[model samples]
Target: MLSKHFRWNKSRVELLGMIILSLFKIQNVQIPKIAEGIISDAKQDSVIKRIYRFFKDQLIDAVEVAALVVDILSLDKYLLVIDRTNWEFGKQSIISSDFI
Candidate 1:
């Protein structure tokens, strides 16, 4: 169901799989860590650079991806829930840029 967004190539699908696997495995999402998880015999530095380049070159449409997910689930009438909240860690400054 989520395969239509990718290009017609194995590398794109492979990268997507790598990203999904890394997301499930790691709690903290780090680019270098995800790159290292890719199943290739290449050097660590090379893999890291390739990952960085892939993200830098590709334009991932986040909104479209989200829409696709919602559409897929809507067919089955699955409940979709989203929760959002904003909280400050400490006292707010009077001259803070976040005020605007």
Candidate 2:
């Protein structure tokens, strides 16, 4: 699929390498591990020769779309933070967020 869209040499590395690079930036993680994880996920797909190449482009596109949306919104100028002195949580699922 990629070969028809891109030159053979670059396209060959596009699926895995590109995805790791893209995911690294957005997720702030390592490359080799990311690539390995991706490979494991795609191990069952016999037709998709390179799982790395497939995810690499998709991850990059997703981040690019997010950045585009932020640009379109341009909400930084109007940003504000409001604090509440009293707060309570009841009967709700709790999810931990590390990145604020």
- Highest TM-score: give the candidate number: 1
Q: Tell me each candidate's TM-score.
A: 0.60, 0.22
Pairs of residues clashing in candidate 1: none
Off by over 4 Å in 1: 71-75, 78-100
Over 14-40, each residue of candidate 2 has an lDDT whose tens digit, in order, gives: 554555455665474544444444434
Q: What lDDT is reached at residue 47 by model 1? A: 77
lDDT digits (tens) for residues 4-100 of candidate 1: 6555267766777777777677644788888766778888788778778778887778676776777766765656564433445577543445533
Task: Please give the distance, in angstroms, between residue 62's alpha carbon in candidate 1 and its true position after superposition.
Answer: 2.4
